[model samples]
Target: MENIQHRNINVNGINMHVAEIGEGPVVLFVHGFPELWYTWRHQMLFIASKGYRAIAPDLRGFGDTEAPPSPTSYTAFHIVGDLVCLLDSLGLDKVYLVGHDWGAIISWYLCLFRPDRIKALVNLSVVYNPRNPSVKPVDYMRHVYGDDFYICRFQEIGWEEEFAKVDTKKLLASFYFKRIPNPPLLSKDFAKMFNPPPYTIPSWYTQEDLDYCASKYRSTGFKGPFNYYRCFDLNWELCAAWTGSKIMVPVKFVVGDIDATYNFPTIKEYINRGGFKESVPYLEEVVVMEGVGHFINQEKPIEINNHIYDFITKF
Candidate 1:
């Protein structure tokens, strides 16, 4: 851990925080909601050991990075721009990219908008959703999944007050383990949902891990993370220019069979049938770890490290 270096670099008009290690072909990691670069610690160390430079950034609006006060600033363009700038600042021409959750979504956009900057991509948990020109993203989710869908709950932007009512560990617990309902209604008081008299965190996540994350969130707050959700509609609007675009970079996708994103009925057919390949023509493989969940990289770090090493090493 001590060998991993942490620093802030100016990118896309914000000071972005990055954690990096090793000295070989670069592997950039992007994280998702309610998470920081810390989420990639195990993968970073493992990938670094495998002769790759592993870099994970606390994407703008998360961790030590500067959070713009507006949701609009959290759009795909803004985040992607920050990343491209970060790469440029590091003198990296191209990198093997890996992302989870929101990071996966943003990486898809990065590939679409700037394929010239990526050598290959390994996206986990979330699959690419090619823009649907007819309807906005939030509207589409609302129609298909309903207004109470988790994304819809974040639309108006007051989740933080209710989020504050619970302990940071519990908030992390609810997010990391609690299963969302079939229609994905994120209860207003959802933070308390993880409670049971004798609570337990997965054995893989240690108390030190929880304490570290708790301390970071205590300083940064979750609004920065929530803002990513708030920009769904705006991203749809801004991304119209690339409505029919496809991700051309070499790709490998891994998901937990039980992950909510993979369980979406449309998604299963899309991934296995043809929609995913149609959207990402260069996608090379898809791996579903039998019993794993959304946080696959963290839950099964050794396996994920092997996955990243095996795939990226081929290029």
Candidate 2:
């Protein structure tokens, strides 16, 4: 991995740390949960080598960045505001935006709220959840499907504490490499994240990666990232301001077919109706890799970087 320089800047008065490489068209990579700027190490080098300025920043509470005290600070608007201020801090009028997981959620909201600032939008893993004027994510999911959905449970109390208490070794093991146990604990174990046996996170995560994440959570804790869930109602409420809008900029989305998210019966409809397909006026592509999972960037950097390069270069 290429070692890059870290730059400190104030985004909306919060101290934010960003790693930047190369110098050309700006391509800002935003990482997801349980990850940091280091997660984009491969992409940064690949984009930089192509003469583009590649930047990856730890979202407010995720890494070396400042973790605001209140869970409310992690709201969609606030997260997007961080990016806006980050762009201003870098003196960038607009830049190509690429994000994964939580970052994709924020990127979608940013595109909805501030399309003028993104030259192109590329998402990994997380797809845009369409706004349902009358229902929340949990209620909507329950209404469409049964209540066994894991994310619905993630919204309940003590979830963060459970996640926080997980063995860092196990968590890292799951992400770094694919070593899923046979008969994998799927729907039966998400709520039992604190349980034993196959319930524990995989061993693919290295100690170094685990240490990096654990250190950050030790200071910031999971409350901020968890708050992203708490704001579902708020997100829907805020989104009411732009009910019928679509992401009009050039866009691309990629995900792993094995991602737990695709298991949802509504996932296909969500992708089509939630603005990834022809719904987005300028959407360029949507790719679903057969064997990858939620951690696309880390699991398959070459594919991620190639798609990104191909997308941005086309524009």
lDDT by residue (tens digit), candidate 1, 32-98: 9878899899999999888889999999888799999987788889999999999999999999999
For candidate 1, list the clashing residue pairs, or say none: none
Candidate 1 at residue 296, lDDT?
A: 88
> Against the hidden reference, what TM-scores do the models get?
0.96, 0.86
Candidate 1 accuracy as lDDT: 0.87
* Poorest lDDT segment (10 consecutive residues) of candidate 2: 179-188
After best superposition, candidate 1 residue 85: deviation in angstroms? 0.3
Residue 48 lDDT in model 1? Answer: 88
* Best of the candidates, lDDT: 1
Q: Each model's C-alpha lDDT?
A: 0.87, 0.75
Among all candidates shown, the one with the greatest TM-score: 1
Residue 39's lDDT within candidate 1 is: 89
